[model samples]
Target: MIELDNVSKTYGSTRALDSIDLTILPLRTTVLLGPSGCGKSTLIRLIIGLIKPDEGSVYVEGELLTPNNIFALRKRMGYVIQDGALFPHLTARENVSLIAKHIGWNRDRIQNRIVELCGLTKFPVDALNRYPAQISGGQRQRVSLMRALMLDPDILLLDEPLGALDPLIRFELQTDLKEIFKTLGKTVLMVTHDKGEAGFFEDTIVLLRDGCIIQQGTLSDLVKKPADPFVTRFINAQRSPLESIQNKADSKVF
Candidate 1:
């Protein structure tokens, strides 16, 4: 449903993205997986129409993502950045219902949507009444997601949504997020530096380096046949030595 045709973006002497041509399918999670300084976030911003491409074009659904059409296009997509990006002054419920209220939704409809979103995200009912500062980091992330999904958008863009949480909380959120996606069946484009997270959460993974796509495929495709030594090493490093131990144990038991 989204296509990037020969797109490029430059900043002074450096190119953040160079002739990047990619298409993201609907009703599936596609991950932009790469290390820092790899231009993943730049791609996300371009798709969101936050910045114009230096060349080519970005198309959402079928329309060109231009200034004139960006407003209406954005309303059909949801985005969650690194931090929860919640309003510190507003309660969780307030944050979620803010957009609906802005669109002139009545109290009853807004309240019902808030309730439904909270239930869908499994955010605690009591936490909805508290300000952002009153909740834990994980809770704040959930609230951010709730806010993004509040509008019931067709596409979801998540930029390292669990990047800042503690390891334990991060793991929990990852599983919860996967379950939520499976249940909702919303098309998602998630950008993350964590290879494990990308492999575990995505149906297809696109590996980028220096503003270009190096490889894109399923987890098995990447692990068994990385495009080059760099990708091979990158994927190998993420596999723990404990995997050998588990293999040996399974062999003995079987």
Candidate 2:
């Protein structure tokens, strides 16, 4: 659904993306996995037209993404950031309806969409009147998702959507989000540093380092045949606390 051809982006002397080529398939979840400064967020910004590539081009479907068509094209995609990015002054309902209202959606249509998204994200209807500060972290993320889906975009780009939540809440949202992705079947490209999160949600995992793709494949493929030592280390370097405890119990080494 999206394609990047020889894409490159630079800030001063630092290159964020270097001669990168990637194709994101339709109706599937793809996770961009790497450590900090690996250019995952830069790639997302390029796709969203938040930042233009220094060289090469970005295409959504078949059309090139340029300044002239960016505004219209962005309407076909929904974005969510780590902090929910809600306007603190607006109520949750208002936040979700911002885009619809901007595009001149009638009251009935806006209300219906808000109701539908609240149900889809399991957000409390009564809480819709509350401000972001009045809600829990989980609720804030839900509100953000509701806002993103309000337009029913063809592609979803999430940058650490659950990164700020507590472990339990994050796990809960992860499961629900996977189900939602399956049900909607929209093209999804998410950036996450967590290996477990990538394993859970990714149909394909694209591993990057120093602004270049090292390998792109399933979790098993990455584990069994790492493209480089760094890939293996990145995959095995992180383990949940529960998994660590279980490993100790299994080995009787504690």
Candidate 3:
């Protein structure tokens, strides 16, 4: 549903993205996996029209994403960033309903949508009146997600949505998120550096390095036949301690 054609972005001397050519298919989850400073976040910003590319074009459902059309185009996509990026003063319900209210959704519609999202994200109905400071990290992210989905956008873009949570909470949210994605069937593009997280959401994984896409495919393709040594290293670098020890023992036994 989204396409980037020869897209490139730079910041003075630093290249944030280098001639990126990517196509995000409809109703599928695509994870952008890479180390820090590798341009994953940059790509997300580009797709969301937060920033313009220096070279080439970005298309959403075949329409070119330009400054003039960005405001309207953005209404068709939902975005969730790290720690939910919630307004500190707004209650969870207010945060979630902000966009809907701005677009003139009635009170009944907003409340109904909030109730639906609370169930979908497993957020407590009672906590709707609580401020961001009053809620847990996981709940904050859920609030952020609800806010994003309030408009019922066709596409969802999440940037490290679970990055700030505890492992257990992260795991729990991951499972819920996978189910939500499947249930909604919206085109999803997520940014994460964790290899296991990428594999868990394994519809397609795009590995980036130094602002360029090094490889794009399933986890098995990356593990079995890496395009470059960096791809193997990147995957192996994030292996769990137990997995690392097991790999060593298996190698010695063989």
Off by over 4 Å in 2: 246-254
In model 2, the Cα lDDT at residue 114 comes to 92
Ranking by lDDT: 3, 2, 1
lDDT of each: 0.91, 0.95, 0.95
lDDT of 1 by residue, 73-150 (tens): 998899999888899999998998888898899999888888888888889987789999999999999999999998
C-alpha lDDT (0 to 100) for residue 41 of candidate 3: 92
lDDT of the structure predicted as candidate 3: 0.95
Off by over 4 Å in 1: 239-254
Compute the lDDT of residue 179 as modeled in candidate 2: 87
lDDT of 2 by residue, 1-254 (tens): 99999999999988999999999999999999999998999999999999999999999988899999999999999999999999999999999999899999999999988998888899999999999999999999999999989999999999999999999999999999998899898999999999999999999999999899999999999999999999999987998799998998989963
Clashes of each: 0, 0, 0
| TM-score, candidate number 3 | 0.96
Candidate 1 accuracy as TM-score? 0.93
* Each prediction's TM-score versus the true structure: 0.93, 0.96, 0.96
Better of 1 and 2 by TM-score: 2
Q: Residue 178's C-alpha lDDT in candidate 2?
A: 95
